[model samples]
Target chain A: MSLVDLSKQVALGIDIGGTNTKFGLVNHRGEILVKGSIPTDEFETPEEFIDALYEKIQPMADEYCEGKEFEGIGVGAPNANYYRGTIEQAPNLPWKGVINFADLMTEKFGKPCKMTNDANAAALGEMMYGAARGMKDFIMITLGTGVGSGIIAGGHLIYGHDGFAGELGHTIVKPGGRKHWSTGSEGSLEAYASATGISITAKKMRAEFPESVLNQYPEEEIDSKTVFECAKQGDPTAIEVFRYTGQKLGEALANFVMFSSPEAILLFGGVIKAGDFILKPAKLHMERNLLPIFRNKVKLVFSELDEADAAILGASALVWEK
Target chain B: MSLVDLSKQVALGIDIGGTNTKFGLVNHRGEILVKGSIPTDEFETPEEFIDALYEKIQPMADEYCEGKEFEGIGVGAPNANYYRGTIEQAPNLPWKGVINFADLMTEKFGKPCKMTNDANAAALGEMMYGAARGMKDFIMITLGTGVGSGIIAGGHLIYGHDGFAGELGHTIVKPGGRKHWSTGSEGSLEAYASATGISITAKKMRAEFPESVLNQYPEEEIDSKTVFECAKQGDPTAIEVFRYTGQKLGEALANFVMFSSPEAILLFGGVIKAGDFILKPAKLHMERNLLPIFRNKVKLVFSELDEADAAILGASALVWEK
Candidate 1:
């Protein structure tokens, strides 16, 4: 007990998203040996969630069984916290309040489990594998529903006094604005920045231009992707919407640059699918809004992570890191 | 030499402001035995800066001088970096790029020296002695000509890879709305949120309210204090300006909250003198911009610190911490 030996075992990474819950067995090198996903809505209770997850891993565990060489389990969820080992009222998930998620995982499998928010986990995934490789000080912002943030400083995630550090989405781009759900502002960055948020803004623009090429699509079915496609097809309204979205994202990023002063900020998530539309305006606005010293020095780039595997990788990373 | 056990000695804290250079000799509790200030502009060279400083500190040192007990010096200036031990490109101080300020201090007095930007040092000071005492995670924002920020997470200053982690003032609040000399657009929150920035905004409002009480003051001398005074006298224009500044500040703070998720964000410096005029608006906006769960949870308050001795207390803490 005095001098406890360290383990050289690997870990399991789990990424829980809205549509899917993916699982992966990963090594320290960020390699994914086995990976799979289960429809998230299939499981209701916490026990059921773990039981179903265990069922998926059972076959692979039997095939690659090597005693209990696995060290622990790492999970990345929409609203995960390492310190609390729980998910606190994730907007999408049915779970509410503090859930001893690690304890729940441990109760079922008898293994240590660690977890952090998806954004934070994504940051760790990037650090271990994707774009953030070799970076000791960088930040990851998921441009999805809202601008999710994960901070890395001195080669470690900055989980503050509370487990809920690194919530970049809520930062305001336009004060006293209308409304947006994500990033905590009604008319804040999320209102016009995130995909769902941007789509609504685009919907309004589409309303203004009912005769534009964008009018060809049903408003009810029209989402951000349709807007991006229209922009790619040289539709002026869609392009303007992207430009506005990029500008909002860029403005919000400017504030992040000031707070964390990171070397670079990585981007991920679905809405970034608009890629050029998303990045170009963001870059332009970011450059325009940056301090003289910080201008052109900070890098804002998209994340090249595998969307499906990222969560599992991020979740699995939880075990090894803790 | 085997252990090289560093002596647990006291340090000298020096805070050089625009008007004066305050000095303190003390231990780590942020306490001070003897402290005072000397005019800084009176000196010309680095030699003079050191000479004037030592002259003020020598007597105090003699009183508590244990010969080998005094370890080194820690300084906080408008622009400083502990890593490089220099003051690079300071506007307030005539010093240019990379002045080995610590070396100059050590050369003059045979002791080690450390330095950091004033805001960064203030953050350390707050952690060491001020209201954020003993807190492992917190952010200190100094509201002056431009807002300044210093971040501490997990009991350490978040010095990024480039030693420039905290830069709250430059965080982007406005996307592409305005032009500013300080932070430009790179999302400079100071562009629309800082006291000076707010005043500029208020002055612009004069065109609409030609007969408003604010029009009495010349545009150049107008400031947050005057606006606050007007608000107190029931001037709607001043009230609107305060609300506007607070909203901008709150919006910026919401983004910062996500980044660090500190227990509380401690506000200090000049603009805060307007008190609730700023705090009320900021708090409202912060809550609106904050994650619903984090809403009504984060504490936004003023720094309960001594203006005269804070710099000295913080500077001295630099040495005491080591």
Candidate 2:
């Protein structure tokens, strides 16, 4: 009834990462109208970073949302707390200490803003627009440089008491097993299931198989992509690397399934590009570990969202969610 | 208002256990006006059990709710599906297959009925009347013959897509370590954290220390209670058993904390009777395994509810919750 067309309304989505910070203006139907990117470490302080983000995004908003209402802002960042609206001690971020990200964004843009961790944002995006549409209970696992997760139960993101829940990446799968590179926690899902972990596995397994295509690359360069390509070329060692990674992932998935009993577990980010090389063994081990009541029930599917746009879309989805 | 006094309403609470079935008429203040129990295995079928339960509880309900309104029925049973209102494939129950427990109760009593697994009922009890009275996010662990768990997040039980959620007991803590006696799952939390697991530890550790008081008891007769008694008498072997059990429990608790950042974790049933011996090490290991953000925040406490009355109280809480 008002002058504004609610359907044409757009949200400003921001994804802050270690290397780069991406922002986009997105419509209600998960369409990105305009987007921009900036190096994350270009600014020394969070204040400077906010100013830079505003400089880029404000002009885009003016051009794209001429007839539409701008529906505030939503941000996804590492170590972000939904309850506190702050990013606390993110190891990868340029800014250290607790950054009052939402308040700062709200202040600069003169609009309300909501923020959550990148993993949780991905879950929101999936719930609203992607594979998890109409699903009430599910887990979104991001298998990137580091493993990350967001658990959705009863159609709500479980932010927990402190809004720091759903750290499945840090949940120990192997007690006293592989030590995490940064956190120092032994046998975390991140140590075995992440892209970094896959690379580590490839490097270790390749040592025993000099004939493998994985040996063609130097130890430092033997990453998940290299392993995937080698596996595609019928390298036994590379195949075994993914198989082992999947086994660890599946074991952790079994633990997660038993915890919340989600309808599905959606895998996201770079590592899933390995396709069935990872999914097959992950599914097999997950089934092997689950109890009879839970076995063969939970769907383990890949994310339908494009990796490049997912972060921005997921961040923007938070605005609509609020 | 009508002639009926809402403040004086009473609920019928039933706890269906493997060995015995207990029922009570509980008031709003969690006071049991009348209570009774019957051997669970005495009846061949669920119908017979229900009829017998009805016969015993009907007169008590009449006496207890003489001037008050009876506020339906709430039941806590093994493998109870809250959404389906059924008990499915409970290994210990005489009722082999899926029994429409809530439906049967409703039809028999001519009133509304709700049902959930016993552990979940315990959590409800804690939320309504015990240690977790004002807590919105917490986990309830019942360490009886077998470990059982009920997770409460945002003040609602996570029933998940299926009714069977919060099965933390069966979650693997020490992957490929100790094998569960019944479920045959290896290194489950129940296999290490339960009273049965404690006895197993006690029996195994007692062999290494022949001079310890634990050796006084026959291997077949050794149980959690026996270990607790010996530990109290300063038997090193018995003390080691509790420490080992606590270590395993603590490690699992750390995993749970990372999954759902609850404010507290309330432990119930027989194993907690070891008190500080179990609690101290459990707290230590849980803290040791946790990431910095999660450390020292989660309270690991014993259930404040009287174990004898907890099941009935918890069951009755379902009515009020609804």
**How large is the interface RMSD of each prediction?**
2.1, 0.6
At residue A94, give the lDDT of candidate 1. Answer: 61
Q: How good is the docking of model 2, by CAPRI class?
A: high
Model-by-model DockQ, in order? 0.67, 0.82
User: A1-322 in candidate 1: lDDT tens per residue?
Assistant: 4552233356788888777888888777677778788887777776788899998886775565465367778888877777888887777776666677889988887778888888888888888778888888888888776667789987889997778888766656666675664343555666777778887888889889876678898877678888888989999999988998888888777667766667888988889889887799989877776666567878887786788777677777666563
Best by DockQ: 2
- In Å, residue B144's CA in model 2 sits off its true spot by 1.0
Q: In model 1, where do residues sit more than 4 Å from their true spots?
A: A1-8, A62-68, A181-184, A207-212, B1-8, B55-59, B176-188, B191-241, B320-322
State each candidate's chain A TM-score.
0.91, 0.97
Per-residue accuracy of model 1 over B214-284 as CA lDDT, tens digit each: 98988776788888788899888888888888887887787788678888899988888888888998998
Best prediction by lDDT: 2
iRMS of candidate 1, Å: 2.1
| lDDT per residue (tens digit) for residues B98-131 in model 2 | 9999999898999899999999999999999899
